[model samples]
Target: MAVRKIEHVGVMVTDMERSIAFYRDVLGLETLGTLDHGNGTIKLAFLGSPGAGETQLELVQGYTGRLAEEGKVHHIAFTVDDLDAEIARIAKLDVTFIDPDITVLPNGARYRFFYGPDGEWLELFQPA
Candidate 1:
């Protein structure tokens, strides 16, 4: 068996509009599309960067089940060229940062954690 690459990451959100705005306005991601799930209850919105073939973010709404303490998934990380700049930009928003300061791995990669509109863990990672 062989796996190529991840198609997209799905996140559960309470409000579709709010989630779309947060991922769009705050994170600079564009909404690729949206649709009602065949189940007739869940609504999904797919978002992604402008570039072709970038991993997409899928927002799932109307999920009645309980979410884990962390969120829909453990966390979703976005690659950043300038972590400091991104940190400063997010600071001015009405978001919460999970990390007090940037964390540096042994390889010199740095990352910071923050919360999304629905309390989902989001991260900005800068490679060494």
Candidate 2:
């Protein structure tokens, strides 16, 4: 009930710089910024059209070098007004959560990962 919209779609990439360049140069999207995950092993870059309230494309690196059969599309993120409320609400559902606790990024954005019915990755994100 807390979800507002589809926030962003995460795409797994082997090279952050190259992926940023491709999204920027080829797709006409601007590089919003990049962040190093608290986990230390993962790097993330966000790209989107140069405007506010636009859906973004998140480039994720260092998750796993070997791509899975599901392909590079890592996860779908949904914007939530109240992450905690959504977490509590979703906990009653049958879906499985991938993260035990919410992850707060350096920029203050918070997120929690869960799984869809078909095992696809899903994220509930509250932006800073």
Candidate 3:
């Protein structure tokens, strides 16, 4: 199978407005659209920074009945001209990063791990 690109990352939050405010207002991300999944009281807000989905952070509310895992996500993302610089910027955010150094994945990709507010595992890497 050939994959074009990652659509976006999904985050399950307890409060929709709060999450949106944190990301959209505080983080300065732009909201693309929102999906209201009525099966439950879940809603998905698609957002993008200047980099678009290459750095999209989705806010999903009322799903999973729990928050995302704390470390080592099911999917990891890596996008940057300089990984080290990006890491440094993220570090300044007062975020709790798991590993600030480069990591070797089983597929032989180099990555770094960080944790999101809701316990989401984020992997930042540069393609070989």
Q: Please identify which of the two predictions, 1 or 3, would achieve the higher lDDT against the true structure.
A: 1
lDDT, candidate 1, 23-128, per-residue tens? 8899899988887754658787879997866777879899788987566764676777788988888788866999899987554768788998987777787757
Q: Any runs in candidate 3 off by more than 4 Å, and if so which?
A: 51-53, 68-128
Kindly indicate the candidate among 1 and 2 with the higher TM-score.
2
TM-scores of all models?
Answer: 0.54, 0.93, 0.48
Report the number of the highest-lDDT candidate: 2
> What lDDT, from 0 to 1, does candidate 1 have?
0.77
What is the Å distance of residue 15 in model 1 from its true position?
Answer: 0.2
> Per-residue lDDT of 53-82 in model 2, one digit per residue for the tens?
568999989875677667789999999999
* Candidate rank order under TM-score: 2, 1, 3
lDDT of 3: 0.63
Per-residue C-alpha lDDT of model 3 across residues 1-128, encoded as one tens digit per residue: 12234545656677878888888778799887676654647676768885655656767676454433652123345455556677778789997778746865333445576887876676666544
Winning model by TM-score: 2
